[model samples]
Target: MNQATRNVLCMTGIKKSFSGVPALWGVDFELRPGEIHALVGENGAGKSTLIKIMTGAYRRDSGVIEYDQKSVAFLNPTEAQAAGIVAVYQEIQLVDFRTVAENIFLGREPHRFGIIDRRVMNTRAADILERLGLQIDPRSVVGSLNIAHRQMVAIARAISFGARVLILDEPTSSLTETEVSVLFNVMRRLKSEGTSIVYVSHRFEELYAVCDRVTVLRDGRNIVTRSLSTLNRLELVCYMLGRQPEEVSKGVTAFREQSQNILDRPVLLQAEALKYKKRLDGVSIEMRHGEIVGLAGLLGSGRSETVRALFGAEPLESGTVKLEGSLLSLRDPHDAIAAGIAFLSEDRKADGIIPELSVRENLTLAALPNLTQWGIVSRKQQNELVERFMRRLDIKAASAEQKIHELSGGNQQKVLLARWLCKNTKLLLLDEPTRGIDVGAKREIQQLIAELAEQGLGVVMISSEVEELVEGSQRVIVLRDGQSIAELSGEQKNIKTILHAMAEGADRQEAVGK
Candidate 1:
């Protein structure tokens, strides 16, 4: 057989650029029929670009794409789908108002002599679902089904198209462990039926469980392609991050070391056995007065969910939250706030600040009840409180009357901090407080957090940067799949330790294609 036709799909020297800036260069990728190949890469990598080019969503600047021994160029995704190459992105593409059968046979419905045949379409869709081991009803609304079933419906639609090559991007990102297990079973069934799949995921366990060969792309280039069993988690991470295992160092943030043994301080907040649907599974933590405890985890690792649970934002399955040794039952954010707990959300624009409001109004929004008397807000009280915090937090703005949206990211964050401080918040929950801000602003926030801790305020902070979490917090609590797996304090609080804890227990003996 010729080299180009050797695999079911092949690309050679694929290069794509935007305005003279190359996103992919000398990229060679191949897909063999009946094999599950894993495409792994970090953010800003060429993974999306390469996938788009291969799927005809974008035209390649220079490359040769051969599918099934025939060199073809598809102008759009519809053409690619017509040619038996289909992709199901992370965001499920389906009409909520449409039925499952309708979504499956949407553009290509069975017809009966100038009239659509619903019976035939339903039967065909049901057959495909049954074959894929899914029991969903054909007439069920797509929106009425859960994410796992919706995904299976998508796969069934692809199978209906006779898709020889299927690309699944982050298929298990929102799935539970049990749902993930079911998805892997379906994927194995597809592989046995001679369907090639491109599995893209960040979960190390899923790759070992379902995929055969792994390809790592970094810095707009293909780094390595190897058997999943050959490389460990650290090596794979190193390839994705373009770093040696020993090169993963710390001290990249502006936080200075703090005093240990703050454990003797009064326990401010104690949460145990926190469970919220699939996001939080038995997460527990203990925070002391004037102590900063960091929550470190990958995306969707329950870091944000844990803090939200503490804030009474998420409905819990079963848990106990104690503040100052008093068992507190919080039903909503109002309850949490009334209990003297303040929260600074990760998404400042959406959850924290009202962009249309003025700096003074936003700062005094949280303390409105105190500033209000007999259903009237005292402008004098609000203005005085705003001025005091503006001077204290160094919130630079043209004037307190200026809209918050006009201020820089750092100044907006300062105003938000002042909002919580004016309410006499006991335990401050900061989720990515310094995120989306400039370096100088981030340094200011970090310094302010340390100063707040010194003033005897208990803080629980969530940060994606391992160095920030490790250095800023007196202790770091690592979360994985909604579970509090490790709590590092003193000597154990470091980047390497947290990364190892996050990746531990994921490597299983189940070797792919052994």
Candidate 2:
């Protein structure tokens, strides 16, 4: 390429290995000036390895990297930052003991006579926050701010570095819908100022919303690079998975094929007006056996809180839950488990997986008491149970002894699902079951959910995607401002119908909910 049309950042023949195992095999990536480039693939697709190499976290075994018409080798992140390249990671890396202003100008504080200029630093920090449309105070302590604010602060800190090229890894993982819009605005503003951004995220919608171009990686090799507007969602998924559109697109709504007669079926769970602080004002749910009931709502509308209340994780002020004609506890999670209730939380890394434990250990963790006989556990029985679920779920792990953290996001999620299936659980609450997984793994997990429900397991699922709720659930309960405002089923169980209730409140035109 000529100098006039040369890529602002280019890496050719990039190769890296960990312990002699290939991570990136001759990966080629190019970033044009003033563009939002998306780097995406399934877990273990070497996306992170490439980004780390760019930021000097991991040295490439062999490669050529050109930045701004000059070949450069950065030995550390400090050098990379000095060269006007900064990365804001998924996990916020900042001192919680300091203020937002202090964290933003941590090393390069504007100084008068070499002394720290607190006034000038705070003013500059405030200006940066204003530019990003953040309402946060510059003097606010980082520890006291909420996760969304902390994430914004991390972005602001990166912006303060005068970055010519910025990398954002899962930046919206902790953000709300409105916050995500603000972040996108900031990104667009930076792009207009001739800053190249490399966005790494598993969320496809976000890529379609803001990304200009995308590069797909698979099995440590570059698969395809194309303008996102040229490829549809199904086509993009196909490239990332190396599958034909017909093969991967089948059975997307296969669960709806099974007939569900909710009126005649026995009720597995009957939650009566559950109240949890302000989040759940009075949400009620009725899930029948051999059926999947969906909870639909916007953020803070109590979709998750209702499930948590049913699982006994959220202590309700006043509510009653019945499981098979017996009153289930509304205070203790252990009691809920003993009563044959299983809950898979939305944030798997935070509430679900025991990262340091082995696959076998994590699988059998909740069932340990049952597996133990007279205060002593049988290793043979535990191993058999673990092996059975692993095979059933098709979890891709090296061995039963492999650490849970080493597994991919999809496999870890499957292991968590297996954790409950190993028990004699009757009612399963899955919150965002397929979030952050690849198309192939997501399809597998969705198929598994359908199979489990077909086997007579009562399921109550919550998904942010309207399509998933309409297709997977027999009926949907739409919540708004902590109340179950509408119930949709039969001919009314489409994406538009459900979204209307969740967003527009049905305007008293629809019949009252059950």
Model 1 regions more than 4 Å off:
1-35, 39-80, 83-103, 130-150, 173-179, 192-194, 200-202, 213-227, 238-245, 248-251, 506-514
Specify the poorest-scoring 10-residue window by lDDT in model 2.
245-254
* Off by more than 4 A, model 2: 1-5, 17-25, 42-45, 110-114, 119-152, 176-178, 201-209, 218-221, 237-245, 248-264, 269-322, 325-333, 342-423, 428-455, 458-514
TM-score of 1: 0.81
Model 1: per-residue lDDT, tens digit, 359-448? 998999989999889999999999999999999999999999999999999999999999999987999999889877999999999999
Predicted candidate 1: what Cα RMSD to the true structure?
Answer: 5.2
Model 2, backbone clash pairs (residues 3+ apart or across chains), number = 0
Roughly what TM-score does model 2 have, to 2 decimal places?
0.63
**How many steric clashes between backbone atoms does each model show?**
0, 0
